[model samples]
Target: MGKLDLVMFEEEFTQLQEIIGRLQVDSSSKVVFLVDKNGQQIAASGDLRSIDATSLASLTAGNVAATDGLAKLIGEKEFSLLFHEGEKDNLHISIVGKRGILVVLFDHNSSLALVRLRVKKASRELQEIFEMVEKRAQSQSGESSKFESPFSEITDEDIDKLFGD
Candidate 1:
């Protein structure tokens, strides 16, 4: 399998944050977070202190992967969206491009229909930003071919020195 590398430049990050911000307001969601397919969080907005963002991102990706596998076994291409409704809060999870996932958490303040509508718009914007970042990373990779790996110069002595008393 090819390695997965996502490069988020400052401009791209800013745009992504704006998208999440808009979604949060439009959908009335308590939290909105973007996660890559590999479980790395790109951006988030809303009440982040109430929950563990990293754990949520990781679990969301795993949930998508499990649903995708289930779809394949049943002869479907893939399930692009998954919804989980709770007593007080609900989750709207959707795929962004093939390599990213968008997650929204909302309470009774927002209706599912509205969340879906706003998420649809945000997903399109995020996908475009992600594509731009991917292309830039690809182009930059070629230009950095002359740089040597920093780890190559590190020896066992260097490791031991850092830990020594």
Candidate 2:
């Protein structure tokens, strides 16, 4: 999973957290989490005590990446949504704005149709927030050269040595 370039401000972060929290309740889910493509947990709400969030985020990102590969192989763009049903639980994962992955965990109490409906609305709102975050990041990066290059310290000598020149 590659890192996402969008820089989220505190305001946007808080807003997104709230949205995730609301989605958990509205969807009657056990947990609702927002993760970046890089497997970084942006915001999560609900019962997280039993779950290892770090693992969940990383694995979820990997799952999305694999699903995307499958999609391309079938002459499709990408599988924007995924669902996994377990014996006791189910997961609904959706890609938001091509930046964040929203995961909702539910059980028999919630129907897939209802979760999909709620997710559709929440995804739109999340997409808007992500767009704002991207614009802000672009403006900030534009003002400074720091964000432009991660290896700015590398010199001609370094490259020559790397190539055994």
Candidate 3:
């Protein structure tokens, strides 16, 4: 089956925010954020005053999709991690729980080794949280399927009578 749409609870959201904040600080990154595979922002932390978050998330997702195509062509299952070094900054993007993307932005002040180590730990925590969200979504879907709508038995005649001319 395809991935279920996430229904983020407040508790999970809070956890995600905490994780992102800690990651930004721990990795010594300028910014850090999480986005779902569909390019929906989950949580973000650190400096975002100059970034277009919506566009970044959407573009990141598209980048991942393009990379996935390349990976397949090379007979690789998936490239879980990607890095781009720019003149003044760098981007470290990793896949989390096969459902989310974790992006970290850093510059000369940080070392790639430190950022990768911090990201590894953060990714594990994020994966667990995402799994919890998935389980909750599955259970809720199952429960909804068992629910009998109150209007299910209503007939056309009943509806017409309620609004009769």
Per-residue lDDT value at 30 in model 3: 97
The number of the candidate with the highest lDDT is: 3
Q: Please give, for residues 53-103, the per-residue lDDT of candidate 2 as tens digits.
A: 999999999999999999999999999999999999999999999679999
What lDDT is obtained when candidate 2 is compared to the true structure?
Answer: 0.90
For model 2 the TM-score comes to 0.84
TM-score of each: 0.87, 0.84, 0.86
- lDDT of the structure predicted as candidate 3: 0.91
For candidate 1, the 10 contiguous residues with the lowest summed lDDT are: 143-152
> Tens digit of lDDT per residue, candidate 1, span 39-69?
8898999999999999999999999999999
Residue-by-residue lDDT tens digits, candidate 3, 1-165: 765767787899999999989999998999998998888888999889999999999999999989999999999988999999999999999999878999999999997999999999999999999999888778877898664556669988998999883
**Which clashing pairs does model 2 show?**
none
Residue 78 accuracy (lDDT) in model 2: 92
User: Number of backbone collisions per candidate, in order?
Assistant: 0, 0, 0
Q: Any runs in candidate 2 off by more than 4 Å, and if so which?
A: 1-4, 145-165
